[model samples]
Target: MHDKYASVVKILHSEASDLMSLAILSGRDPFRFYNGADLTSLDLTNQNLTGLNFDGADLRFAHLEGASFDKGSLNRSVLDAAQLHLKDGFEFNYQDVLQFPGKEILMFCMIRSSLIDEILIDFGINYSVFAEFSKISTGALRKARVGKVIAIETAQLIFNGVFRFSKTLDSKIGMKCINSIEQPCAKMLVGGNNKPFVEISAEDVHRLFEIRRRRIAHMKRERGTNASPYVDYRDTAEYLMFYKHLVDDIDFWTKFDEESA
Candidate 1:
């Protein structure tokens, strides 16, 4: 695979004066270890990029229509103004190893609340939460005896109540809360100023999950007693959106590490 890629890279470099334009017609599917390479503004329509590692590469303004990125690592790669349209069953594994360049702010906008929660919880990071209808504050709510508040972002909320602690120490207390449903609640510490923290109750998470379950149940009932194609496709798309950010974040962090090293 390495030899094939080396040949393609040489061809891409020698054939065309414009390297970006050369990559557009390189006919190199599944390029191996293509890192920090500039392929900006290339047209990669209907390309099969399965298992491609675009770590620390620039793909700005590239055309990726109908591209298959199943199991690809796009860590810390730039996709600014790039067109992306994937088919069904696109699998992507993204973590903190990816990064987004040229449009860092826009990349954050694409991240989902569930993905953020997964990343933070896996890393054992502390987060603050408030009511479902309220906001999260790091200062004022530290004094409240509410249930577990895991993490609070602008769009989504997470909580788990499985433990508790006294509110006496000079530092903030981390604990859990158990509701009548026998579910675990999460309370955590977050960053912010003296603003009031909106606490999302443990019941809210259960209720939201329950609502989603019922919605899917109803769809299955209407579509068929066995399965609903639309629900499956929708769920797949939602999952893809979450994975995209993970890949982007991983790429960003990897680049940071290299630069610092």
Candidate 2:
């Protein structure tokens, strides 16, 4: 019952749909405080909704065509058959990989690196800047607790996470790296239209990965550190786009989705 409009809504029906309609007519979003509210087969097609909380609510067979799907709580709402335009980063969840495994999360990384490279290039970042991103991403992959077994699904999640990290660095840490290179290493880097870059061959990046892989292989940490020459720059930059809110599915009135989540 609406505390503010209970008197006005007294004449209205008490069913979920009737209450939902009253709530809408009362100029408030529909909210079911019970996260487990079963809202199966509600004719919610193409309706602009607000104040709707669907956290853990069952929306199976709900008609949601052309309506924004991110406006409610869907912590674990059944959303398989809903007609919605979902984006990749959303991945059909509240901007998280909460249900996906580490392997599946990592799978997205296979193409993530390349996409990052292209975008950086588009932004006029050069080899030095690119190398910094590469180093950061590659090293992070090694230290990630996602287990040694990387699969497509897991990689995608990891890759998306790393992609977000790079964006963050671009604003925070990338500037420092760019400044340092422009000062002392300007001559060694390739020059973009508006940025300078370092000389990093594909082989160099590959070597970095190889080093990270074998760093902990067949040896003790002390011995490895003493004899091995692998360098990891995980702290320099981090990936954070995966399991994050990329876009869409923004249930603002519900606990199902989170902007920071």
Candidate 3:
């Protein structure tokens, strides 16, 4: 069993229409209506996310190991590189089509989908408040994915705001069942190695925000000419490792223990 972070996901879709105006009015883009989800590096480790639509989403590099969900959840999604296992004790690793070695060098690299959900769900956040921050155009990130390549900063604001813009809800019947039983969710992130990582703090999330805000502000002031000192960019491997460590630390081996028992 695993923590799907599904309750947190409810924050993004709970009451989208009421807050659309504020979401549209804030930050850089002032008039876009969208509320669809695109996730990569999402840790759906042992939660039920049945029937969730992830069309046009980049689910590359997600940690789905030991997680259970209907296949329908990933409808029309891009799963270029993902770690998964439908059964207990199975280590699933998938490689993507991206990142070929260049110039006679033998190397391979991949990426997470870069959605806001992917970045924060692992922090054990209860996003009930963000659901009401503003109504979101869930389709905005998909638009950015298909229409124009968005700046990393813009994507951060979009995904982060979408969640903060959401409100948490009562757990679904299935989620309640899982919680009531105290079924421990797998603590590992999607990667080659299965290990528990570290626990994240509120400061870490806020730190990410402050860095992005300052960078975005500076980009606006300088007209997208230079990089911000505060923003620490993680390459694909590093990004995966950060999650791997974080996910690994959270009840990391519980699933394996269950399987071996």
Candidate 4:
């Protein structure tokens, strides 16, 4: 199977824009076939690319709009300015709560749990890779994994590490559109007049991260030598909501540049 996929990749590389190579991958797991392939500027428009694994693929400027990739993995793939179909809306719920213990320790547990690791997995990347890009350090990442109450700076570091670092060209363009334009872009609009709902800049995310850190510190201090700190549910809820929106905003913006173009 591996050899077959390797052969397919060789063919794909030779015929960079060949639909026949893609047709050969129809109804099959295209992960191995396209992984690490130089698919730059490929015209994948309206293709059924469901569940394709594009890890390490250089898809810069690829046309991906109208394509379906509901289960595809673009992990660590370069998609500079690649057009993609954006999601209609964002969804968040308790199911996304990572693990148990409920809202009180949601944020901490999210950090402690496999959240970042899971994200890295989707990106076909590892903690060390994220550390190198995020500059948060492996030790600090480990501490975060252990659910330690990280400092405010570290919190911002983690946020930047996940979202800001290693951004594709489209991500940068989308963010610029959001920041520069006063009019509502994409689904980021609100009311009938299409006013901007919110502008969650890197600074805004950092502020939320700081607020979350301060709340954790305050809760720990209040506990005061008794035992473990009780994470406040309300505080966690507040930050988590913003965190969800921030994620949605990023996702939307990544696809937003194409619409503006």
Q: TM-score per candidate, in order?
A: 0.26, 0.27, 0.20, 0.32
Q: What TM-score does candidate 4 reach?
A: 0.32
Give the better candidate number (2 or 3) by TM-score.
Answer: 2
lDDT of 3: 0.34
Worst lDDT window (10 residues) for model 2?
181-190
How do these models rank on lDDT, best leading? Answer: 4, 2, 1, 3
- Candidate 1 colliding pairs, count: 33
Model 4, 1-261: lDDT tens digits are: 576577566655664444435646443544346667898877888887653445567888887777765322453366674333232121211122222233332222113344455546545667888788878788888776554444434544665555554354355443332221111111111111232123233233344555556656664777765524345443433344333433434654443333323
* Tens digit of per-residue lDDT, candidate 2, span 1-261: 558877356536445443346555555434544246676778777765433445556777777665543322343355554333232221122122223333211212222123334335444655445445445444444433322332334344443444444456656454332222111110011113333222322232333334334443433454656544433323100121221233232342122112122
The lowest-lDDT stretch of 10 consecutive residues in candidate 3 is 90-99
Residue-by-residue lDDT tens digits, candidate 3, 124-162: 333333333323344544443242333333333443353
Q: Give lDDT tens digits, candidate 1, residues 111-159.
A: 2223334323433535453321134454423322232332223212122
Model 2: what TM-score?
Answer: 0.27
* Global lDDT of each candidate: 0.36, 0.37, 0.34, 0.46
**Poorest 10 consecutive residues by lDDT, candidate 1:** 175-184
Query: TM-score-based ranking, best first?
Result: 4, 2, 1, 3
